[model samples]
Target: MKHDDYDNLNEGTRSRIRAKRRKTNLILNSLIVVVILLIGIVSFNIFFSNDEGAADQNGVVAEKDQDAASRDKKEDSKDAGKKEDSQESGKKEADESESEEEADEESAEEEELSDPIVTEGGSDANVKQTIENPEWKPVGTTQSGEHTTVFDQNAVDWQEMILAYSYATGIDKDNMTVWFNGNGGAPNTAVGTISEKGSDQTFRVWIEWVDGEGWKPVKVEELIQNDQKQS
Candidate 1:
């Protein structure tokens, strides 16, 4: 309490009291140091734990973003593949349609052809039969524009005329002999006398020029003799 009272105490009691105070102070200081160390350990654990948790959270977020991007890429690839497939399919269908159209055109062209007509000839001359074909098409020509009847043996028109005669009379060109080729009764018309080389199968073939088509045989008369043959 009072310094005068403590100083008036006995020497042995003063010495014991002073020693007790020193021990109590030392124990208090040691307890304070232990409390400080405990506080530091707790703070360090809390800070590090929070940092690890944040890192784990960031990692989860990053993983989710990567997964989303991968999914988007897959979707885009699928869309591109689908677009390519659609284009290829359309092209295939167009090609098939064009091919079908071409086939139809070819079939239509083939349907236009028909057989020839054969009938008995008049008794006016040595005629066997009359041959006519309504579906007869002119032989194709290399010539263009206005047509003129050519009678020269080396002319293209003359060669075509002989071809028409062979076509109408059903005679092979190699086995037939052309006796005459001259102008008929009308313009753009010609008559030819042809006979089988080694036989008496003679015919008078009448042919006419048709614009774009070459020589078209209009009539064919099977003759018993080549009346136009030169002596």
Candidate 2:
């Protein structure tokens, strides 16, 4: 409209038009502000929700890691326990093997020793029984090289003869009384007559010396009486 026409219009009409425009502008401004506020609230809620979701996901991941670690620890402990048990079992087996080896050695030693042979018949009336052992070995000798028979009381041969007599008759030195110790009829041979300390049981032992070996008992005759005993 021209300014002349607007000036020709009544005041009431102009006032109403201005008031309508003012009301419309006020409503539009208020709607815009409300829409902006709603948008801001939605954005805030979305941001907070996203942050909370991320936190929950991280927490789940952390929980899974902890569970995995715990399982690994338990498995390691089980493995360690099995290793210890295996070691203990191995130790027990080794001990059993050692015990078996020891038992075998002891059995072998027992098999090496043999019993003597006892029989009847003697050359004299005083001789009752005879004894011999094929398994008997020399008691060993300290003297080497050439050997000479010594008849002295303090001779080494005499002491060794007594040992042979005791070995053949099963009579110890502490319980036996020597009746006679002298040369036998053959070369490199000796004879000894002995009796128990408090009994009439007597024995005559014949021993021979080998070139390299010591005195070894050849025969033992058990006597019926202590006829060779002195005093």
Candidate 3:
């Protein structure tokens, strides 16, 4: 070919080579800027791993709603401590049924003041209105042998012819201290002695007391005298 023609061809060739290189360099503009920075680092790691898995699913739904509000505040404090222990066990069984109804009304007032006097055969008891005619006083005068024991002291028990000879001889004396041997006496202690001095000499009286179930007897002071006219 001609010299100029050859030279022109060579120059063209070089230009083409340069152009190719430049094209390759922009090769995908750096592969499209590294595929757009690997798609922006995989979309910021998939949006930071979906915001840390949605904050761990909202912290497990707020720890299961604070454990269901602490198990409903411990079941409302165990049902308010079992309703205050069932209202203190129903007020301790209503104060033990009002102290057993005031101890059965004091045992029915001690069985309505006991004793009613009834000699067996269908039973009945007597005396004990606090020992019949209690309250006695005067306490003096004593001359044993020829009999002259004018003394008295009571609280409630034997007296008045030893409580009528312990109830007309059904004798069962307990806690005693009496002396009778004169001035018109009689109540069947096997014929309570004292052969006569009546119409004024008066008589019958001897008593005492200490009780809790000990010492007892009383009744006198009403024109007293006792000088044993022995019977």
Candidate 4:
């Protein structure tokens, strides 16, 4: 209805609208600040959690490596000990083997030097006769002025013959005279003389008899006379 009344109404409406816009802008700014703060907090938590997990994993790996190293050391020690034991065992076995070989050699030497008169076929009675009576008579004679005797056929070993002659003659084997007859007259036969009282007593004794050559005396008087001079 009038100009003055219309102007007052327009001014009041403009003031109310300006106040409402300012309040809306303040509320929107506050919400944006809250959202930014929440995002920053969440990012910090995630980063710290990842760092801690990495550190734990590194510790676990270190522990596993240490365990492996310890186990390796133990295995190495065990191998070294086993090797030492094996070497000791080998040395002991070698020593025992050497000792056994030495014993065997000694036994063989003893057998070689054993008396041949104690053979299976010969009697101990004959050996006793030669030992008790030193001047036993011979059974044969020869052309060379030598005494001879035919030892038992079964007791024909030359070593036994030497022992029997030594016992019967009472002559030391070391000091007795000996000669090897290589004429192939008889097996294990020797033509020699046993020296007594600085005189030689010749004899041709057959250890094993030959064909067409029976028991004979080579020189009975010469041998007995030498024995008497020594006595």
The lDDT values for all models are: 0.86, 0.85, 0.48, 0.50
- Scored by lDDT, model 2 comes in at 0.85
True lDDT of residue 80, candidate 2: 100
Which 10 consecutive positions of candidate 3 have the poorest summed lDDT?
121-130
* Residue 89 accuracy (lDDT) in model 4: 94
Report model 3's TM-score to 2 decimal places.
0.41
Model 3, clash count? 6
lDDT of 3 by residue, 1-231 (tens): 999999999999999999999999899699999999999999999999999999999999999999999999999999999999999999999999999999998787555533323222211122111123322222222212332223243422224434443432224334332334333342211123221222333323333322222222233222223333332
How would you encode candidate 1's per-residue C-alpha lDDT over 12-38 as one tens digit per residue?
697888899989989999999999999
- Best candidate, lDDT: 1
Work out the TM-score per prediction: 0.50, 0.53, 0.41, 0.39
- Is candidate 1 or 2 superior in TM-score? 2
Off by over 4 Å in 3: 27-31, 36-42, 45-53, 67-71, 76-80, 105-231
Clashing pairs in 4: 140-216, 140-217, 141-216, 141-217, 142-217, 142-218, 146-218, 146-219, 147-218, 147-219
Backbone collision tally, model 1: 0
